[model samples]
Target: MATPRIDLTAAAMLLGLAAVWGGSFVFAEIALRELGPMTITLHRVGWAAPLLFVLVRLKRLALPRGWRIWGSYLVMGALNNAIPFTLIFWGQTALEGGLASILNATTAVFGAVVAGLLLRDEPLLPRKLIGAALGVLGVAVVVGADALGTLSLRNLAQLAVLAAALSYALASVWARVRLGDQPPLVNAFGMIAGSTVLMIPAALWSDGLPDLGLAPVTWAALAGLSLLSTVLAYLLYFAILRRAGAANLTLVTLLIPPFAIFLGWLVLGEALPASAWIGFAVIALGLLVTDGRAARALAARYFLHTVTKE
Candidate 1:
């Protein structure tokens, strides 16, 4: 059998996924202007849930067999979607849009570290450690050194954003262990379901039905977030996960910062400071190192020779 080469379809899907997630921050900001964090989060979860359910049913995607998988999916949904979604919205409510994005970029570093600790087979390598450390340093730079000492509620809110990333990292590792074998659509559907159930009470108590008096722009942003960012982006993500594995798919976080920064500039007229650009570059480099593509090539060469000799 021949070794499989990466197809263009997968590449395009991944790119689209990255772009959607990157641009999500901008939409989140727009939505936040008129809606509370809980309200916006509910829109994302509630709308996407039914839409994804319809899509899953149309595709006839069956979930994995047994309660263990369903139970795990419920937990994964909370960690990956409900909690982080709410946290980022709340964090962004107090923080600058660009600053919140910079904080969200920490997801990859947290994912790598968490995966190493929680996963038995995926041990931490020296290179990955160095890469993750560099990525953290870049995040600090991107957020601007001046913002660190604000000593106000916003600072704490930014920390909450970081905490959300940490939770997502844990969720990623947990998903691999518990739900990796299930079809991508099934897993995605389960997550949307779980998030909907979890967010209902919070949305009702906090927002009490989205203030229908909001401007059309706010409604448009909410729609974009639910349909494009939450539903479509996740579909592409799950597709990539099925083809590429979670470890590889997760590396897209490295690409998200630059894309998010660019979108912020384009959509929101936000200016990127020099430090943020530098931080973006460093984070990208760190992700490349952690992915271990070069190591894989070298290993392939060594293994090929041994096999030939045998």
Candidate 2:
């Protein structure tokens, strides 16, 4: 099958989605001041799930029914939302949001590896291997050689965020194979619903009930995280996935780091080290290589024209 081309509209939506997702790191940081990681993760999905169901109803879309579909939703929720959200929120407690976002960008690298293993259509290509290697090297650079030598909690937290990224990669592969035919909104709703179901009990067990006397800013941050990042971002995500192929959608990962860093700096006065910036560039290069756009462009510019002229 031919890949879908990303038109200008889809490109715009992709960028918008990247910005929303990137901003989530900043919001998570703000909300973490008052709420526990479990509470934040629970509220994120709990609030977004009902709103998404409302979207499903208003659009008159059929809700995916049956135990099998709900079972898939439960798995997706665990992979995509519950695990990642909790880990990321907990990691952000120790790491800066910008750094967390850079680590999160590794999702594509992991996704490439996961897809190559799981999907018959996406075999492990040479370029992908190189890209994945570069990405891992970039991560090492970001974490610094010294920190890696020690078993510090900070290092553990960073690893947790990367683990979350891997979970997202696995979830993406699962969705492609199992739930590709479902409507994007329906999938979004179902996954969030499943996340809510899983998170509520976990939050109660871990954090107990959330404090009702929390400050307004924390509440606002929670709302922003749930409404803007979780709900609206997924809608845009599925829309872009429909119009553009997954390769094009992966470009959003490249766009996220800058936005995240900038928002963290602007909002929280957080600054990244020079090494983190260098590592981020390397990761971006890996993403470009993995996406095949750099090679394609070179071919179009140099090889294709020469061959066609002959």
Candidate 3:
């Protein structure tokens, strides 16, 4: 039996999800200027909760009724959302925003490794191995050669951010292996609820109430972060994961740096350093190599569709 064609709309939706999520790093940077990492993460999880709950009620989707599902929610919630989100926010405090965004791209490399190591269904294939290698090289280029010396406490913080990326990558694979059949909202609520529970005391200890008195610009940034980056991003992400395989969905990270750098240039008036431009080119090349799209196009031109002599 012939396999049916994949839904192009679904692929486009997944791509849109990727673009929105790519902006999250910039949003985090904006929120961190006015709010501590814990505070920023707290507001996002807490504010989104009630809204997500209401969404569940409106959709008539039951909360995970079983402990098994609940446990999945808790574990996934922490790994997928809370811990990593907080790490990236704090790490960015010390690192250059662009460099931080570039480092975060390592999630694709980590995802491939994690999926290959843990998931029986997703063994490491030649393409995956090549893709993973290119991704790592891309990340290296994006971080620049000089930043290697900056690794210390700040470097450790950057690693923590990368760890967060790894956690997110692992969570994607884990959810597919474990919660593939669970509702998207359930997975979302789990992470949001778990992150909220974890952020409470941390928020209190890190900083007192975030100053709402900041310029309207700050408030606007906060709203943008919470709504577009956090709330909507999560929902769109899991929806994509549900439709496309996790492996396919995780490639979104590859494109994140470009969009992030573009937003930074447009909104923050930041110029892309020469190194950043070179890094961007390297990363783009790596993605092409990793996916074999370049090779595939060549094969189609020279080999695959060519007519043979009768």
Candidate 4:
């Protein structure tokens, strides 16, 4: 089977989706000051689910019925939204926004590995393995060698964020295998609705009832996280997933760090060290390697030269 390709339109949507998700780290950091991690996850999916339902209605899209479909939605919700969102928010409590985003870049690494194992068409090429190694090296560089010497709570928090990325990778593969044929809006709606179901009780058990007297800024962040990041982001996510396979969709993770770093610096005054920049460049090179287009072009050129010489 041939490798799936992402068209330019889908690629643009993926970048837009990455920007929106990158901004979410900043928003989560802001909201964490006023709310617990579970509370933030609750409100994000709770608020987004209704809006997505309304969008489904407006589009006159038919939602899939029956427990089997809803069950799949529940699993997708856990992997995609509830679990990852909560973990990332908790991790952000201990990590800078840029660091959290950089850790999240592991989603592509995990996705590539997961897709290679589970997806027949998107095999694990030698380039992908080398790229993943480079990506891992880049992450270690960004995190700094000194920091790795101690296994502190902060390192654990970083691990949690990495785990969240892994969850996202799994969710992408699950969606491709199970709901690839479903409408993007419908899948988005169902997943968020299912997330709300899981998150509401989780919030109550972990954080008690949410405070109704949050400051205006916190509320604004919540709205941005729910509306732009969760709702609209997932709409774009499923749309791109339809056009691009899971591995391609995960490339958005590679684009997220820069947007996140900029927002963190501008809004939160979080400054990154030189190592982080070097690591980001390494990660970018790894992504290019993972893409394999340059290697393919080079091979084509060599083949043409040989043909002409012959």
Q: Which model scores highest in lDDT? A: 2
lDDT values, one for every candidate: 0.80, 0.91, 0.72, 0.87
Task: Give the distance in Å from residue 284's predicted Cα in candidate 4 to where it truly belongs.
Answer: 2.6
Q: Cα RMSD (Å) between model 2 and the true structure?
A: 1.8
Q: Clashing residue pairs, candidate 3?
A: 77-191
Where model 2 places Cα greater than 4 Å from the true spot, the runs are 1-3, 305-310
**What does candidate 2's lDDT look like per residue over 126-148, in tens digits?**
88888899899899999999996
Q: How do all the candidates rank in terms of lDDT, highest first? A: 2, 4, 1, 3
- Cα lDDT tens digits, model 3, 129-201, are 7766766666666565666877566667767777887888888786887777867886677668877888888
Alpha-carbon RMSD of each model: 3.9, 1.8, 3.2, 3.0
Off by over 4 Å in 3: 1-16, 149-154, 208-214, 238-251, 284-301, 305-310
86-167 per-residue lDDT for model 1 (tens digits): 9998998776666677777777765787888889887998877977888788777776677777767777787888889898
- Tell me the TM-score of each prediction against the true structure: 0.86, 0.95, 0.84, 0.89
On a 0 to 1 TM-score scale, where does candidate 2 land against the true structure? 0.95
Most TM-score-accurate candidate: 2
Q: Per-residue lDDT for 171-240 in model 4, tens only?
A: 9899999888898788888888889999988999999978999999999999999988988887888788
Clashing pairs in model 2, backbone N/Cα/C closer than 3 A = none
